[model samples]
Structure formats: structure tokens, C-alpha cells
Target chain A: MKKRAQEVERALDVLLPLPEGPEKRLIEAMRYAVLGGGKRLRGFLVMEVASLFSVAPACAARVAASVEMLHAYSLVHDDLPAMDDDDLRRGQPSCHKAFDEATAILAGDALLTRAFEVLVDVDTHSDSQARCELVAALGAASGARGMVGGQMIDMLSEGQDLSGAEVTRLQALKTGRLIQYSAEAGAILGRAPSHQRHLIAAFGRDLGAAFQIADDILDTEGTAEEIGKTAGKDEAAGKATMVSIMGLEQARAHASMLAEQAANYLSSFGEKAANLVALTDFVVSRRS
Target chain B: MKKRAQEVERALDVLLPLPEGPEKRLIEAMRYAVLGGGKRLRGFLVMEVASLFSVAPACAARVAASVEMLHAYSLVHDDLPAMDDDDLRRGQPSCHKAFDEATAILAGDALLTRAFEVLVDVDTHSDSQARCELVAALGAASGARGMVGGQMIDMLSEGQDLSGAEVTRLQALKTGRLIQYSAEAGAILGRAPSHQRHLIAAFGRDLGAAFQIADDILDTEGTAEEIGKTAGKDEAAGKATMVSIMGLEQARAHASMLAEQAANYLSSFGEKAANLVALTDFVVSRRS
Candidate 1:
């Protein structure tokens, strides 16, 4: 996972080389948001899944970078005062704090736009059909019915008591869509059969749910230094989360069950799915 | 132009069909922002140039709508409190004012994402290569090197004196890139030769500059009622504009020269370029 994250970091540098000019600040902000930190879990997922299909590392690298860029944009926006309002991210000042709000917003916008550009480039995929499919799929994952929609639901549901199912649906929309896309990108790139793709997608969905539950658990139990962000924000904000709805113990059990179910979907890949299965365990068991 | 605008409007509706459930608010905000008002000059440029290539209206319409959505997203973000901070847009409350800040942000994000999706959809183009080209061009026009960069320059340069050359470069980045892409979309769709695409791009460049100059002029001369947006905002904000850099008469002359130069580039198409020629004149002459 660390090796894949490093590969993605290098690919991102090559893809977004610094330019000389006044507009260079925009690129700087973009680089800061993307290159600074994070587990690069989404990028890792893209590479791991692509490895299953024996896709070239170069091809998978760009796809992974694209997902990382998209994830970075979401975090930048989510950290804005209008959204989650976090001042710290990955133990550093968030994008809005490092720069001004306007610059941060434009940086996020550029990153998102650049992600699609990266996916559609000839270096990413030789076939136009594959490129278009990737673009369309990423759009569905990031747009109204995906990440943004989930964000809207999350903000709206704040302060209002939400049932366990409602919280699950909220998390599904907010984070699940992009997580699923990250895992499914490999199959799209590899031209996997429908059944195999379905299995991979299901693995992603279960893994994503487990991942969010684990995150909620961390919010309640971890320290700010360990989490690299303010701890207990969800509870302080009275935001609906799996832990809040299911209770901490139940949420942990549910997450473990989901991790197992996520691994079960990978049985088709047999022993080759070891990395993904390990990833599922890592997601649920991470301390931060 | 009015006829083309209406066609673009209908295409937007078709491209972004209404959805039921929680995400409907997002769709509504998108529709309200895109459908409520605008001259649809970008869409008109797309269809008019595509007409020269004999590309089907159906194909051209989707491209036009995509540009419109992109433009609408810029407007929505530009109007946010942290940016331009305008409450009014096209005689209506801006998205944030109408739908709240979080929803407005999501709607803008969705619109931007949807633009790429619209371009790549099979219905937009039977040729995957054409769709890929369209996606790439739009991405280039909208990303850090283009519109967003221009916006960043605009904000940073606020209240600071700038030379005419600096202002031109700023506007070119802020708005010229997408305007250029709108014209280039036709050539990509029609599979025009390289030199022809360059000609169309140059025409878009000149026309976009002239259109911006005319807009600046209207900002000085027109009322809010006439313009459908706040009048005199440029002066009030103390922002540098074409009028601010060049004296008013010189600015007008520059715009007129650009309009003529823009028309000259379309001469390769002769009579087929008639609408484009007329558009250059309209761009400089329109009150709104």
C-alpha cells in the first residue's frame, strides 16, 4: 500500500508539473491539497484492483492518480467553512486555512476538472471507448447522484435524529459512490466480465460501509494528534453517523461483519484477492 | 440567436432529466441556474460554428448545453459569499440565496461534473474520438490553465492597478478559454482539419474579448433592469476591467476592431459563416 501511494504521488507530480506565472498559485494550492498527505487508500484500491486484471502499472498509475485527485478535491471542499469547517487535515492546515477561501475553492474546482482530463488523456487509455466509459462513470460517482448529493444529505440531516438506515444511506451516497468507483476503475480499465465487475463492485460497497463505520469509531475514540484532525467532531456537531445510530459496540461489530462480507465477495478471485481481503481488515482495524 | 438559445434550453432539459427522491433538490437548483436566464451566447457560438460543419443539431445541441452547464456552474460559484458575493443573478436570487449555501455549492459541483458526462454520452456523439476531444478541450478550458486560473487572477488583482496587457491575459484565462472551446467544439464534432480548427479558435478568441469589452461597457451604461444583473459592479468593486485599463473610447474601438477581426476568421466558410459573422456584431452591440 505504501509503495502504491508513493507511485501515485510521483504520477501526480508528473501529471501536474509546476508552471511559472501568476496562475502558479492555483497549481501550488492543488499540489498542497493532493500531495501533502492521507493514506492514499483510494489510489491504493485502484492499483490493487487493477493488479487483479494485470493492467500495466503505468496505465493503473494514472487512474489511481485521478482517483486521488478527485478524493483530494472532495476533502478540500468538505473542509470549507460552508461544509465540515475543519482547520486541520493530515496534521497540516487545511486548504482554506493555508490559502484564502477563494483560492481553495478554485483549487478544488481545478483538481476535479483535471481528474477528468487525466482519465480522458491518451496516456491513461488508448481506446476512446474506455476513456469515455471512465469519464461517464467518474461523473456518476462525483456528481449530483454521487458524492455531492451525499454531501447535501449529510448537511441537511445534521441536528436531526436519523435512523440507522438513514445514516447508512447517507454514508452510501456521501462516500460509498467514490469508494465503489475507485475499486471498479480497475475492471473498467481491464474490460473485466460483467459478473466479475459486479463482484468487485459489491466488495467495494461492503468495504466502503465498513470503512465509514470505522471512521465514525475513530472519531469517538481517537485523539486529534492520532487522527490528524479534530476528534469527536461528529458528536460535537451532532451529525448523524453509524456510531451515533448503532452505538459504538454495535457499529464495531457491524463493521467487522461488513469487512468479512466484503472479503467474501472476493472469493471469485481466490488467493489472488489476498491484498483486497487484507485491505478490508486494515480498513476496519485502523486506529486512525 | 433567440431560436438557438431556446434550442439549447430544451437540450439542457433533455440532458438533465428530472430525478425523483432526495437528489431532486440538486436537479432543481441546476435547472433553475441554467434555465432561468442568460443570453446563451456560449451555446449560440457552439451551434453556429457546428452549423458550418453540417453537424446535426441534435449533436450540437448537447454540446451547447454542456457549455451552458459549465458556464452556469462558474456563475454559481462566482456568486458565492466567499467569491463575488452577489445576491442577484439574471434578475433572480443567486443559488445560495435561493437554496442555501451547501445546496448551492453541491449544485455547482454537480453542474460542472455533468458537463463532462454530457459530452461523453453516446447520444452526444456516435464517435468516441469526437467525444474524447470534446471532453479534453472542455477540461483544458475549464481547469487551472483556463477559466479557474483567470478567476484566481481576477480576485487577486482586485483593488490593484494592472496594465492593459495584464488585464487581457487575465480575461483570456478567466473567460476566453471556454469561449474558445465553445467554438472549437464544432470543429471537433465536425472533424474539421487542423488549420480550420485554429481559424475557429482564433475567431473565438477575438469574439470573446469583444464580448467581454461590450459587457464592461454595459456595466458602465446599463441599469440593473436592463442587464438582468447588478449594474456598475465593476466600478463599485474597484476591479480592473478593459474600461479601467484603456479609456472608454479606446476600449470601444478595440472591441469593434476585435469584432471585425473575429468575423474575418470565419471567411473560410463564406456564406456558411454568415451566422458567426452576425454573432460578432451582436456580441458588441447587445444591451444585455
Candidate 2:
């Protein structure tokens, strides 16, 4: 437990608010939005995979922190009216809700920009090759081609019925790509090869698919009291989620199957990626 | 010139308009914002510096492209309502004006994220030291403590009273840091040491201050027809510009003084950084 917490504390440092200045109040707000709480799960995945490579905790921690910054930026933007229109995030006031619309927009903009800033700053990345690759992976995941793209589709298909494949594609881009990058980043630092990259990709994709399904189930079945946030958003939004298209039981079964597949993929790493192994299980086990 | 244009075009093929999916549309737009029309002077600065270090055009291009992305993103966000609220940029419809506000916002966010992504993906930057340093420099420039912070001060100070020193502080944070990073990043790629980095810093700072002071002058004296976008905004908004507070004649003199100081700093580069040397005069001389 102590070890787990020490790792978490290190991760938190990456999440800590940036130095203060009189001019950038909105940036200050953005830092506040990121610094506020949630699972910090994405950072954990980065660190966990790095540990598997025996790459030292600090190196992984930097990448992990970088990923967290990306995630926070997405959340801040997602909560805006053009996207989810969410008034709250992480059980607290959303960035836009807490700040004005323009401030929120600028804050989110700055946060996304700052995420890259944090990444390029870390002493661990070495040369441009290592730094650039990590930046590419994260950028692709976050941009319209990935998470933002997924979001665009989600918005357009709000009331339309999407196929199972469509649902998976959306989830894969929106959710899975980042996860893929998280694990793959560890592999990059670990100096894993093309074949290993394939395995990690499969694991991340399956895990992301399962994770999305589980989220669908949770939103449909979990209560706000238990989940600490609103649920049933998929149905209300008329969104075509795995549960919406496949039915809740089938979605649950699919999630289970995917989680199993994810675990199996990690077998190649032996025990090096044990926590990553555990995380697959943890992803599907969440109530919220 | 032919060779340089070819290189820029080839890189654009690899980089621009990011193909056609909706998820990638914003990425494409962001790419477009940075790609067409202008002389690509900033990109030129990066590649030229890299060449001096014996780095390939390919490696240098990546760094150049990344900074351009940063510049483009800032421009897009700056054009938004809460900031400059301009309807045109680069003599065309602004990103927000051309696209919708929401899409423009996401595009800026994506580009900012992509700059780091470009840095992270550089296959050649295996030397983690250089990559890490580059990333750190970028992060500092983009974050609230740097460019965004400066912008915030610029925004808040609008229509308010301010002393000359206060204006200098704002210009340094808002403008100087990015230019400083551009020079610093190239020096870093060249594996430059402290003295060289310091020299570039001095050059960038002096040049940036002059460039902004010129902008203040343009905002007063230049027409919308001449500048390609809204002019006289500083005066209209009662912005705490160098010209508004100190008068245009004095600001012009200061700009010249700054340009001279910036040119003096170029002496340390030993004639190797000739393009950067010319670029200072170019930035200060710009009518637009």
C-alpha cells in the first residue's frame, strides 16, 4: 500500500498546479480543473506499464503525468455546450460551469496546449525521437482523428442507431487509442519491438472496448447516489452505446470477453505487466 | 529557394490536411491554418538552425512544423470572441469565422496538442536529453506561466491604465517566450550549450519586444486593408498598448532601438545563423 501511494504521490506532482502569475487567471483555472480529483487512473496505467519495462518509476511517471494532462484537457472541453454540455465533472463544478464560457473555452485550450508543454519538459525523454513519438501518440489520440473525432461522431449520431461495429469504432478511437498509447509508450521506453507492440495494441483495444461497455452498463444501472454522478446518459442522449445496440446483458458479456482477451494478451510479458493485468479487471469492475 | 519549397511541400504532404474523416477534419483545418499563404518564415528559422547543427532537413522539419502548429493554434484561439474577436485572420475568414466556434475551439485545442505530438514522434530524437529539454521548453512557453499567462495579462489590462514597464512585462510573457523557444529549440536540437542558449535568448527577447511594439504601431497607423485584418483595435479597445500608453512616435523609436539590440545579439552566432539574423529585420519591418 505504501508503495502504491508513493507512486501515486509522484504522479500527483505531475498534476500539481503550475507556478502562479498575475496575468493567466484562466490558465490558473485550467490548472485548477486538472488538479481537482478523480481516479487518476490513466496516470496509473502509464506508470504501471513503465514498471513492467523496469524503466524506473520516474520516467513512466512523467509520461503518465503527461497523459493525465491530456485527459484533463479533454474533460474540460467535453463539458462545454458544444459537446456534452455537462455542468459538473468529477462530482464538482465543471470548468465551464465554474468559469465563464469564454474562460472555460480558453482554459481548456490552454490546458491541452500545456499538456504537450509538460511532456516535452520531462528530463526522461532523451532525444527528439523519444519525445516526438510520445507527443505523436498522445496528439493522435486526443485530436479529431482520435478522441475529439470520436466526440464529433458521437454528437452527429446522437439520435441515430449505430451498428455494433460503429459503436466499437467510436469507443476505440475515443477511448481505446489513448489507452493503447499509454501501454505502447511504456513499450517504447522499454524498447519493445513491433511484435510486442502488436500484442500491447490488442490488449489496449480490448480493454478500451470493455471499459466503454462497462461504462454504458454503469450509466444504465448505477445510481447517482452510488456513482456520485448522473447516469443513463446514453439512453437519454439517444446515443448508440454498446448497451443500447447490443442489449445490457450482451454488452456485459462482451465486456467480460474483452477483459479476458486483454488478460490473455499480457501473457507475453510474463509477470512484468501484472498491474496492467489487474487494471483490465479493475476497468470492468467499476460501478461508476 | 526551389529546394526549400520542395522540402516544405513534401513535409506538407506528410503533414497537411490529414485526410477526410470527420474526426480528422479539425486536424486538417488546423493543418490548413498553419500551411498555406505565408512565407513559412518561422518554419524556415527552425530548419536553418537545424541545418547549422548538421541535423537533416527531415529532423529539422519536424521541429519547425511543431512550432508552426503552436503559432497557428494560438492565432486561432486569439481570434475567438473572448480575446481578439476578429472575424478574419491571414486575410481570410478566421478559423472560428470559417468554421463554427465549437469546431474552431476544438481545432485550436488539437493543434496545441499536436505540437507536442510532433515533438514526441521524432524517431531520431532517441537522445532523451535533447528531447526532454525541448519538451520542457515548449511546455513552459505554452502554459499559463508563459505564453498563456502573458495573454491573460494582455486581456485583463485592456481598457485599463498601465505604466511602460508593465507593458514590457506583458509583451515579454505574451510574445517573447514563444520566439525565445523557437530559437532555443533549434539550439537545443543542435546540442548547443549554456552560452549559446543564452545568446539566442537575448536575441529572441529583443526581437520579440520589437515585433510586438511594431504590432502596437500597426494597430494604430495601419489600415485594415494594409494589415489584412482588423486594425486600430488596440486604440478602439483602449488596450494598454505601447502606442496607446506611450504614443506611436515613441513606440516606433523603441521598436527601432529593440531591433538594433536584437541585431547586436546576432554577433555571437559567428555568421552560422544568418537566416535568423535576417529574420529579426524581417519581423521588425513587417507592415502586416
Candidate 3:
């Protein structure tokens, strides 16, 4: 896991070079928001799943980096004063707190734009069709009907009495879709059969649900130092989360069940998906 | 011009249909930001230039609508309190004003994401390569080194001394790149020869420069109602502009000269380029 994280970090460094210009600060902030942080779980999924189909390491790495860029952009915007107002991220100050709100906003926009730019580059994939598919999938995963839409629901659901199913759907859209996309991207890049692609996508969906529950658990129980962000934020803000709807013990049990189901989907790949299967356990059980 | 604008408006309405969901407000904000208003100058360029190559009207309109979506996203973000802090856009309350800050941010993000989504769709072009090219070009024009980078420079350069050349470069990156991409997109959609594409690109570059100067002049001379946005905002914010560096008369003459140079680049197409050539004059001379 650490090795994959380091690989994506190196890829990101090359993809986002700082230039000498008046707008250099904008690039700097983008770099600041993206580099040297996070578990790189989503990136790991891309590379590992791509490896199953023997996709080129460099190509997989580029897609992984692009996913990371998109994820970073979401975090930057979500941390804004008008959004979650987060002050910390990945054990450091959030983008807006480190720079300023305007720079943070522009940096997020640029990062999102740059993510698509990277995907469509010849270096990412020689086949333009595959590249176009990646762009389309990524856009659907991150756009209004996907991640941003999930975020809007999240903001609006604050202090509202949401049912368990509603909370699950919100989490699925907010975080599950991108994680699912990261896994499915490997299949798209590798040109896997539709059946195999569906298998990986299913795994991603269950794993994403499990991961979000684990995150909520961490928010409720872990210290800020351990979680690398402000703890108890959801509870304080009265946000509708699985933990809020399902109670702590029930949420933990639900996450475990989802993780197990997620692992079961990878059985079709047999030994080729061993790492991915193991990741399901790590996702739900990790302390941070 | 009015007809092309109406065509794009219809295309946008179809592209951004309101969905019945908890996130409907998010889509509503997106529709509000994009559906009505603006000159649709960028969209018109796409359709007009595509018409020169006899591309299908439906395909041209789709591309044009995508460009308008991208343009609207930029405006939405620019009007944020942390950014330009404008309360009006296209003579209506800005996204943040009509909605709220968080919703506005997400709406801008969704619009930008949807723009790429539309480009990658098969409806935009039957050729996957062309779709990929559009994604790459639009990304390059709107990313950190382009539009967002220009916004950063604009924010940082307030009250600072800037030379004519510096201001010109800033405007080129901020607004010119996207406009240039819009014009170039028509050739891309038509699969025009490399030489023809270069010719149109040159025309776009000159025209974009002229358009910015003309816009600055309007800010100086036009009323808020006429411009559909706050008048004299550049000067009020101590922003560096061509009009600030060059005297008003010199700036007007410079815009006219650039417009003429722009029209000259289209001479290679002979009478087929008549509308585009006429557009140069309308761009520079329009009251708003």
C-alpha cells in the first residue's frame, strides 16, 4: 500500500510541475493540496486492478495520479468556509487555511481541469477511445450527478432527520462513486470484458460504503492527530451519516459486512486480485 | 448572431435538464447560471466556424453549448465573495446571491464537469479522437496555466503597477485562451487540415485580444444595465487592464487594430469566412 502511494506521489510530481510565472502561486497551491498526503487508497485500486489485466505500469500510474488530483480538488473545495469549513487535512492546515479562500478555490478549479487534461493525454493511453472513455467516466463520477451532487445533498441534509437508506445513498454518491470509478478505471484502461468490469465495479461500490463508515467511525472516536483532520466534525455539525443513523456498533457491524461482501466479488479474479481482496480488510479496519 | 445564441440556448436547455432529487437545487443553480443570458459569443464562434466547414448543425450546437457551459462556470466562480465578490451576473443575481456560497461553488464545479462530459459524449462527435481532442483543448484553455491562472494573476495584481505587455498577457490567458479554443474547436470538429486549423487559431487569438480590450472599454463607458454586469469593476478593484495601462483612446484604437488583424486571418477562406470577419467588428464595437 505504501509503495503504491509513493508511486502515485512520484507520478503526481511529474504531472504537476511548478512553472515560473505570475500564476506560479496557483500551481503551488495545487501542489500543496495534492502532494504528500492521504492514504492513496483510490490510486492503489487503479494500479492494482490495472495490473490484473497487465496494463502498462506507467499508464496505470498516470490514471491513478489523475484520480488523486480529482480527489484533492474535491477536498480543497469541501474545506472552504462556505462548505465544511475544515481547518485541517492530512495532518496539516487545509488549502484555504494555508493559502487563502480565493487561491484555494482557483486551485481546486485548476486541479479539476488538470485532472481531465492528464486523462486525455497520449501518455495516459495510446488509444483515443480508451482515453475518451476515461474522461467520460471520470466526469460522470465527479460531476453534478455524482460527487458534487452528493456534496450538495450532504450540505442540505444537515440537521435533517434522514433515514438509514437515505444516509446510505448520500454516502454512496458522495464518496462511493469516486472510489468505484477508481477501480473501474483500471478495467477501462485494460479493456477488460464487461463482465469482469462489472465485478470490479461491484467490489468498489461495497468497499466505498465500508470505507465511508470506517471514516465516520474514526471521526467519532479517533483523535485529530490520528485521523489527520478535525475529529467529531460530523457529530458537531449534525451531519447525516451512517453512524448518525445506525448507531456506532451497528455502523461498525455494517461496515464489516460490506467489506466482506466487497472481497467476495473479487473471487472471480482468483489469485490475481489477492492484493485488492486484502485491501477490503484494511479499508474497514484501519485506524486512520 | 441572435439566431446562433438562441440555438445554443436551446441546446443548453436540453443538456442541463433539471432532475427530481435531493440535489435538484444544485442542478437548479447550474441551470440558472447557464440557461439564459450572456452574448453566447464563444458558442457563436464554435457554430459559425463549424458552419464554414459544413459540419452538422446539431453537432456544432452541442459543442457551442458545451463552451457556453464552461464559460458560465468560470463566471460563477469569479463572482464568489472570496473571488471577485460580484452580486450580479448577466443582469441577474449571481449564483452565490441567488443560492448560497456553497451551492454556488458546487454549481460551478458541476457545470465545469458537465462541460467535459458533454464533449466526450458520442452526441458531440462520432469520432472518439475528436472528442478526446476537444477535452484536451478545453482543459488546457481552462486549467491552472490558462483561465484559472489568469484569475490568480488578476487577484494578485490588484493595485500593483503593470505594463501594457503584462496586462495583455494576463488578459490573453484569462479570457483569450478559451475564446481561442472555441474558434479552434470548430476546425477540430470538422477535422480540418492542420493549416486551416492554424489559420483559425490565429484569427481566434487576435479576436480574443480585441474582445478583451473592447470589454474593458465597455466597463469604462457603459452602464451596468447595458453591460449586464457591474460597470467600472476593473477600475474599482484597482485591477490592471489594457485601458489602465494604455489611455482610453489608445486602447480603443488598439482594439480596432487587433480586430482588423483578426479579420485578415480569415481571408484564406474567402467569402466563406464573411460572417466571422464581420464578427470582429461587432466584437469591438458592441455597446455591451
Interface RMSD for each of the candidates: 0.7, 2.6, 0.5
lDDT of 2 by residue, B140-179 (tens): 8877767777877787777789899998988888877887
Q: DockQ values for all predictions?
A: 0.86, 0.51, 0.94
> TM-score of the second chain in each model?
0.98, 0.92, 0.98
Model 1 off-target regions past 4 Å? A122-125, B122-125
Q: List, residue by residue over A1-288, the lDDT tens digit for candidate 1.
A: 889989999999998989997888999999999999899989988889988998898899999999999999999999999989999999899999999899889999999999999998935446888889889999999998889988887887779998889889889988988999999998888889999999999999999999999999999999999999999999998898988877899999999999999999999798878988999999999987
True contacts kept of each: 0.82, 0.70, 0.93
- Model 1, B1-288: lDDT tens digits are 899999999999988888886778888999999999798999999998888888999889999999999999999999999999999899999999999877787788899999999999936445888899899999999999999999998988889999899999998888888999999998888899999999999999999999889999999989998988889999999899999888789999999999999999988799888889999999988988
**How do the predictions measure up, each by TM-score?**
0.98, 0.89, 0.99
Candidate achieving the largest lDDT: 3
Deviation in angstroms for B39 in model 3?
0.5
RMSD of 1: 1.4
* Candidate 2 chain B: worst-modelled 10 consecutive residues by lDDT: B1-10
B1-288 in candidate 3: lDDT tens per residue?
A: 999999999999999888998989999999999985888999999999999899998999999999999999999999999999999888999999999999999999999999999998846445888998999999999999899999999999999999988999999999999999999999999899999999999999999999999999999999999999999999999988888888899999999999999999998899988989999999998998
lDDT ranking from best candidate downward: 3, 1, 2
Most accurate candidate by DockQ: 3
List clashing residue pairs in candidate 1: none
